[model samples]
Target: MRWLPVLPAETGEEFSREGQPGDAPAGEGLLSEGACDEHSVRADVEAAAGAGIDRRVYFEVFGCQMNKLDAELMLGVLNENGYQLTDHPSSAGVILYNTCAIREQAENRFFSKLGHLKKLKGERPDLVIGVLGCGAQNHQHDIFRRYPHVGIVCGPGEFLRLPQLIDEARSQGQVAALDLDTPVRFERKENLGPRPRHAFVSVMRGCDMACTYCVVPRTRGPEVSRPVNEIIEEATVLAASGVKEITLLGQTVNSYGKRLAPGRRIGLQHVLYGLNQIDGLERIHFITSHPRFMNPDLIEAIGSLEKVCEYLHLPVQSGSDTVLRRMLRSYTMDHYRKVIDQCREQVPGIALATDLIVGFCGETDEEFAETVKLVEEVRFNGAYIFKYSERPGTSAAADLQDDVPEEVKRERNQVLLGIQKRISLEANSESIGQETEVLVESLSKKDKTRWSGRNRKHQIVVFPSQGDEDLVGDLVTVKVTEVTPVVLVGERPGKGS
Candidate 1:
């Protein structure tokens, strides 16, 4: 039940739009940054091994599940280097803001939290306030310009330099953001915590899409997929560590490896084949896919790999081709419907979720109706609906017009959501009285007696615990006794499959 900030549409406008395809900045920024400056990671690894640095460091995480996993990875890197993690931001010597920049609202929230860190620093002047991840990458110069107290601005690629960055930030009061394309794959990075049933493995950094409503290609830089061998190695490590489920992370996950050697590159298919070979891995899932690049081979992998979960989240943005064309989504309604048909054929009973935008510039009532009609045809299990907002310095902001009235946008959003509610309820009703396996995440905060987890289709299931003294991270089976549009209330049926 932890709150994940799905920023208000006004804040995330640019991120939802469309951008140029097959456009990648080819260059040497890949893997250029080393472990340590003036010194090498080998020497620091030795010294860090021998040093008695605190193993317990307090960590603060902000933004998406990807950032949460990055926090996990950063913790892994530090723990491997003999650093401990602490929960309190005030007591810890290192205070890191695991950041996000996909939306202005998130950036504002991070700075609001940073205000607290600065106050803590006022009490202890030597405290290290370091920022990392997408927000750091997106607003590197701007962040420093406003907050001189920030000691370090490390991007998503700079976690490998944690030991070094911490050292310099402690001494010099500043660390440069790792320039975009600096390859610092924590790919082989260890997981410091206990082997959970579910884990996240980031497969790519940055995205090239300029969806007029998105800031990713700029914030995280061009599309860069991790090497397949590296991903398998990491998956093997996770397998050894007891991770049963893995979700491949990326802005456009299906577009994995398209940038790596161009036409000769091994894509997500090769990557999936490698993962299916790993021992002890149970279920796999990936997300935030662009409908344009999720190729047939990747679809085949989802069908062929039993360990791969039976859920797919391909964000359609808008169902109307006119709206999509304006958004520059590049794919047509017929094309998306075809992909849906193809996927349903391959993975029978696979549940589908999507990100939807209701109101965009020049959208008419007919266009809106087209979106609603398409949603009904797709019968999506879930859909995240959004309205458009003008972002600063984007193509949409420059060339296009934001002609839709706010009231009209709200009405369209409500109509779309109203339709989705019925579809989701129907979808959930279809599962009533059926038993399914779920990965138990935690007890529902609303009622501690009810445990919650997601099924293979990514449907949220809440079941009565029966006072069996269960803990989080255990896989269990529950029978769907009742349902809502979004939640499935059930009871423990037996052990997992």
Candidate 2:
């Protein structure tokens, strides 16, 4: 229910088009300019710690679930180091904007927000302005040069050093904590403020796919999976804190445990099986998977596992083999179809979704038709469609020509959206009159009289509120009454009528 600005399309591909963290979920300061040595910075922080100064820190999270989890990590680290959380940026001494560079719009939005923080800094001399995560990594030097008032800029890899970096940034004029190659230390166990019923736990960080159009690998660094034990511990702690549902997050979630496997190998199936055994956990979900890693074992586990939810966010960036080859996606349309077929056969009633990039560097009309044909064959329950745009430093930008015109891109985007809308509407209508369970989350932003939650298929369901009993965490059964493209209008069996 906590509203955070997130780009759903960036959850996987270049944009958060598919497998966004939620169905449709939805800083400041000024400081003196000075530089200090590490020893002095450390001594000042230690002295402040000894004096027990609990400064309030506010976090502005952007991007995907991975970024959200990273923000949680930041908050946990700050909390551990004698810092408190504040909802208001005006009241906080530290204002951190956890960013994403997946889309140009998201990056532009962050900078626009960053510009506003300057006014806050002008008002308060001691406010610490920091940028973390993807945006921090993507525009490391540019950000510092553009905004010299920004005291702290740490990438995802350098997150563990945040507590120390905060001190260094305060004492030093501008501190850049950009360490991409080194693996982050996430072994510590801590909670992110108040626990929600549904939580996102990152199983891994970064990507190795090296897709031509993606900036994730450059920003988040190489893939690194958390130890199986560590993930289980985090899940157990979440379960213990009344979290009924836990969504596993990663750039390529299906490719988890690749680096951690010693020899014989353990995959996401093993991890899901472990989490299933944990007490108090009801449903398990994972997202943003690559097609190449969608193995039969993982598909079978999804069908067999009692706790795993039946929703898969398999990204098919392009259906045309040529575009795919150019993107270096490592899998063909036939391969993708086989994976979809296997998943359909194994996991009955699975709600399938996909990410689509309509305009790629060299996409021809026939190639674009191939993508439409693939979508028609797949009939995805939902999709995140995007018009291709070049990202700086990506292979597509450097090696490939952006030949697709803007008008053509927009036309293709609309065409795909039209097709998918019919498919999604049909899918939702099929659920009419059926009973489904939902973990009631919060009131609908449009109508507060109605409460909202997501079903097992990850569809949003809104029903009339029943008695005001703080039903955020309660699981209730609702009969489907009406259908919308993105939301299902339902009511408690015999109560709302």
Candidate 3:
């Protein structure tokens, strides 16, 4: 285990939700590729069956879907080491907070939670408290300095080494494994536990884009595409284990194979084609693409592939070309328009969504208007809107001034959000009385009488669950009855309807 320099202990207090920490990095992310076989996993479980019967670990995950998947992988490693997963933090001997540093808000929430965890550590000194993921990568040993009781600080790439780190921390008081240069090695024994009906499979890890305001590249290291055969093998395992849908994950998924060895440079289209050939997988999806790599062939694949869902999340950070240039996004408004046009033309009725950042550095009212105009023209089915917050070490923070005032940022954010809410409502309302396929996932928290799932367009549809059937994991026909901006309320289709 590598030793991290322990910083001067600051008195642990309640979470303050204070200003951004000076060391906060860009965004939250993960990148790794490895294949695990079944025999080794079974052997580990058998060996640890008796030892782990009483040990429990509680995980608090934050940020993106990638972070959630990382938590799952870490749980698998802990399980193999004779630890069981628990939901309540107080009941567990080990508590892990999978941290995120995407924005100031996320960071504040994490620190607040960590501050609260300090009391639990004081009460139970034997309990192992650790922080993992992007935030851990950003602060590293400094986390030890701030929260002296924190036993381990590990990054996303260092997750596979978690068991060893936990043991070493128990023996030596504090440990950190924040190395980004090391490749993640997933041995055959590292089983990612039970498979759900729908799962996220990371085809590639890391980002190569030098977007001014983003820290994904720094936290996740360089982009590394997993071998196509390895991905296929993992998907095959998922299908055999009853997974019906698979969403391929990456920071910029469209640039799938650019960083592979000389002869293995395959595009996203080839990988989609290969996944489409899998026997039991019913649907496929990929996300968080950059327009620079959204070539014509990729659009053609989206149009032609039957298994690939009719949904794409192409994040257009800003609508104004000036803003895009300053963000170092490498694409213009006209180029983005062309990509959107081609996607709409090729894949009709596709539900397009985007990630929009309002009030970016130096954004004027006129530039903000351009964003509203783009939103009106695109009429996106859904969007994730965010107010710009400078990330330390990012080019934007280093070179540009965060000139947009808080009031201006709030105004622009609300304006765009209002437009998107209206558009989303109108778009969803159009689906009423239409029949669609929904893959049942779970009981709706809002209404237990109904089950929730998503359609090919990636829209959530909730329908009454006729208790006679096990709808979970099954794709069933639903008739839309009512619509909301966020979800569609539906019912099981009658024989004729």
Clashes of each: 24, 9, 0
Summarize candidate 3's per-residue lDDT along 460-494 as a digit string, tens digits: 78787765666778898899989877777878867
Query: How high is the CA lDDT of each candidate model?
Result: 0.67, 0.73, 0.72
Give lDDT tens digits, candidate 1, residues 1-497.
11122111112111122111112110000111100001001001112233233333555555554666666677667766777554455446676777755444445666877776666777777777788886787677777787877888998777667878888888897887667767756564455332246667888877777777665566667778888888899899988877777878777788888757767967887878888888888778885577888778889899989888888877787778888888877899999999999999999998887777766889899988888888889998776665666554556778799888989988887788688788888888988989988777666646666776677887777777665676566777788988877777777765321
Per TM-score, the best of the predicted structures is 2
Scanning candidate 3 in windows of ten residues, the lowest lDDT window is: 30-39
Better of 2 and 3 by lDDT: 2
Worst 10 residues of 1 by lDDT: 34-43
What is residue 261's positional error in candidate 1, in angstroms?
Answer: 4.9
Ranking by lDDT: 2, 3, 1
Instruction: Mark the regions of model 2 whose C-alpha exceeds 4 Å error after superposition.
Output: 1-54, 187-190, 193-195
